[model samples]
Target: MMKPLPLDKVYRFIEPGPVVLVTTAQGKERPNVMAMSYHMVVDDGDPPLIACMLGPWDYSYRAFRATGECVIAVPTVDLAAKVVAIGNCSGADTDKFETFGLTPLPAKMVKAPLIGECLANFECRIKDDRPVENYNMFILEVVAAWVDPERKERRVIHHRGNGTFVVDGRVLDIRKKMTKWPTYIRD
Candidate 1:
């Protein structure tokens, strides 16, 4: 086998899963929105937490860190092209919400705005920023979350390699046996 893989490569392999829009605000001015893929649900109870990574150069980074608030918007497969467009451009140079024709809705608990077109939006406040400068990691405590009732039953879209996307389809469940098996197992 090849020698142990690099740590950076291992971390990247598990990334680019969800297609999310990271929204941030500076005071009452227009909120900036940028497409992001490095995010995950870290906890469930008592103000659910989410972890997201942002490049130090990203324009939304400072705003989010300053206000300690943001909204994670989950887009659908139909918005895949727009997501790619936003990801390709810098929010510092362009108003992505205007360019993409995405409407902004006021969030209940956070200063950031939510994408109206997204299927779900999570209003979150930064819980920790220690890892931001170190690993581009930011921990957010979800203050409020909402999902479009019409799209509640529909599958959400996820980012794949290149510009491709995969829809969340078909739920599968498998129960693990109480006894342990030494050999490897495949599903």
Candidate 2:
């Protein structure tokens, strides 16, 4: 039995990855953050590349454009509600860090601060901006990364393209099934 799916709802099926908080700052201005779900890993090797979408509509975009750097912080399911609320509001008027009670730790390689509450934070620099004119996309290279090892809840939240969200569940390790890529398998 086949069913029809609305074109607008296709995003729910092709959801990129976990919802992340992007932090940016310029000169002496207060750092700003925005919740983002429209990002993908373009390269996974050393100093990985990530493609993220941001436009003028996003207040942080201006900072990103000015500084050419930002922090991509990965939040767990515990911060799902705050993450959604962050995306709903604009950083122009609201100090997201104060409004959301998120701690901003200094980053090693970039001016953008790292989020202390997130599972992981990737400090990145703009590598390619050719797609920014038409696609509002920027390719970023991770300059440094940080992670909280003490956090127990590691499950990530995924947006369903609406008000609804999906949380990560149990893990199913099938390393034995991956014969060709044994190098990727870990014990």
Candidate 3:
């Protein structure tokens, strides 16, 4: 027999995956980076898309909502402290790039800049905003993606709310036991 669990806070147990730094900006406006965990892949095929959730109260939420352009920077565990610091303050009051001394590289397809130190960077454009009004979610289409060629394998951080964090560890290879899927190619 099993006991009932609280549905409202299920994410605490699910460990909603890794935390990514979402950078957003508009022309003539200062850039913003919010440490975000509410993100997921929507489609893995051509013109891939992702979804990220940002509460209306977040200072960068308005910037993202208005410009619909942002960079999803996947930082490795090496940047855990910087990620925590960025998440602690508001971009509206602080220039996170200057405070953190993070290198901002020009993105290929968006106005927002990408974090040069991150493992991978995805330049995205908002495809839909209907959820921001309902569930505070934004569906984004990835316009450009970059990964550090020198790094063999980068470990990322995962947040479980509160002050708890998880670092990506070990390799789990179950592909041989599962159905072989077609190779995923990126254009």
User: In model 3, where is the ten-residue run with the lowest total lDDT?
Assistant: 178-187
Best by lDDT: 2
**lDDT at 167 for candidate 1?**
78
Candidate 1, 132-171: lDDT as tens digits: 7779998889889998988754566676545667778887
Q: Rank the candidates by lDDT, best first.
A: 2, 3, 1
List lDDT for all candidates, in order: 0.81, 0.93, 0.87
Clashing pairs in 2: none
Lowest summed lDDT over 10 consecutive residues: which window, candidate 1?
178-187
Score candidate 2 by lDDT: 0.93
lDDT of 2 by residue, 1-187 (tens): 9799988889899888799999999998899999999899999889899999988899998999999999999999989999988998988899999999999999999999999999999999999999999999999999999888899999998888887888898789888899998867854
Number of colliding residue pairs in each model: 0, 0, 0
TM-score of 2: 0.96
TM-score for all predictions? 0.82, 0.96, 0.92
Candidate 3 runs further than 4 Å off: 184-187
C-alpha RMSD in Å of predicted model 2 compared with the true structure? 1.2
Question: Comparing 1 and 3 by lDDT, which wins?
Answer: 3
lDDT of 2 at 21: 96
